[model samples]
Target: MASVGITPLSAIDWGAPWLEPWRVLGEPLAQRVTATAEPVHAVLQSAVGARLPVGFAPQSELPAGTAYEQHIWDTGRVPTRDNLHDFFNGLVWSQFPQTKRRLNQLQAQALATQGVRAARGPLRDALTVFDENGALLSAPAPLWHALRARDWQRLFVTLRPLWAQAHLILFGHALLEKLVYPRKPMVAHVLQAQNAINKIATWEGWLCAAMEADAWADKPFAPLPVLGVPGWWPANADPGFYADAQVFRPLRATQADARR
Candidate 1:
């Protein structure tokens, strides 16, 4: 099989619902390809303002042997690449500075104690999962229950009206990058927000406080087919949409047993 290659800068639709939280910082930068790190860093600096916890530096700034997270923790700089993945990562850093820093701090701590072992212990593994593909969901209790239970029908159909009051924010940069070319099966590992957080600042703070090194070992994220969220994708409007068992999978017996 051949690779599709990276999506061009101009091809990204900034107005995408998943991209809404990042539009302010991402839209202007996506206007053209800044193939080098300096221009990308400059735009990020302008967009994020002085409060940005870390500066965006070229990937080369990272020494040959230093781990990525440790470098950021030591120097307060993120090694950025010239691609959509790192671009969205920068947007995330700008939008969720506190949470990003907390994640990095945890990662650095894990690296310090665990070193660069082949098997990143449970805590580090779970952190990587969330960092690469997590989302924050501020929906009603029923939605949360149905989602956690993997009850597709109840989540998207029975209690569908409740979605009007819900908010789903895509936090993971890789998740955001994948949506640049939307696909039905693209899932997000979601963490439900305990309170109704509307402002990005409040959300960031809440997320930072909520993240615990111990709790992360259990991997509390729930899998959600992002596009299936009502109003997120046009095709999902059809009642038959959730019938795709491959995407809206049923909870396995082992998983059900574990919940008991």
Candidate 2:
């Protein structure tokens, strides 16, 4: 669903910090990802009902006769910040030392998709509908409530530790959960534009590393095979795993086909 090339480069795990310039170019791109709502909305909507087949939630435990409902729920469980943190912390955090750099790269890439929204309601509505459709995937009650209320500062303080440890665990291979996030800028912007730019770039570095493993994927990409050995990960999809979105978005005439 991500349509090749249209997927941001940072979405892929290319071993290390290879795209430094792209990360540099990524600053405004990330700002634009936040500036508008439509693109994000489209992504959220299209993704609904598609999350499970891709192995999002643990196999939905519907009655044996209701495999269809099970199919729907599994596919529909869109990744959230809580679920995401669980995935990373469960597997990679303490072990992956380079996770910080990886997450910074992801944030930069997500922000720098340099894409934007042209309208409103669609974004918020899609998310609401998705929540309504799926059985609520359990989340940390405190964090979920804060996010639901749109409490930005509290959400930031609460999620910061999640992201911090997550960066250490998950390599920047997936966009685990971004349900609740910081609203205002994390730091004061200095009067100097260059200083402001530097601050944002720094933030991007941390962001990309934590939230971007296949953050580019339309659904949760291919389900990762379970790794039995502690902190062990099976081989990943090669470089260019979800890069299609970049090329795909540009070639499309409109947003009609862009939904998940």
Q: What is the C-alpha lDDT of each candidate?
A: 0.85, 0.28
Give per-residue CA lDDT, model 2, range 196-216, as digits (tens). Answer: 222323433443343333432
The alpha-carbon root-mean-square deviation between model 1 and the true structure, to one decimal in Å, is 2.8
For all candidates, the clash counts are 0, 47
Candidate 1 has an lDDT of: 0.85
Which regions of candidate 1 are displaced past 4 Å? 1-5, 32-38
- The 10-residue segment with the lowest total lDDT in model 2: 185-194
Write model 1 residue lDDT over 1-260, tens digit each, in one string. Answer: 01256556666797788777778767877664434323555666666747788998878899998999999999998988767788889888888888999999999999999899889899999998899999988988989989989999999999999998888898888988888889999999998886577778888888999999999989999999999999899999997999999999999999999998
Per-residue error for 89 in candidate 2, Å, reads 25
Structure candidate 1, residue pairs in collision: none
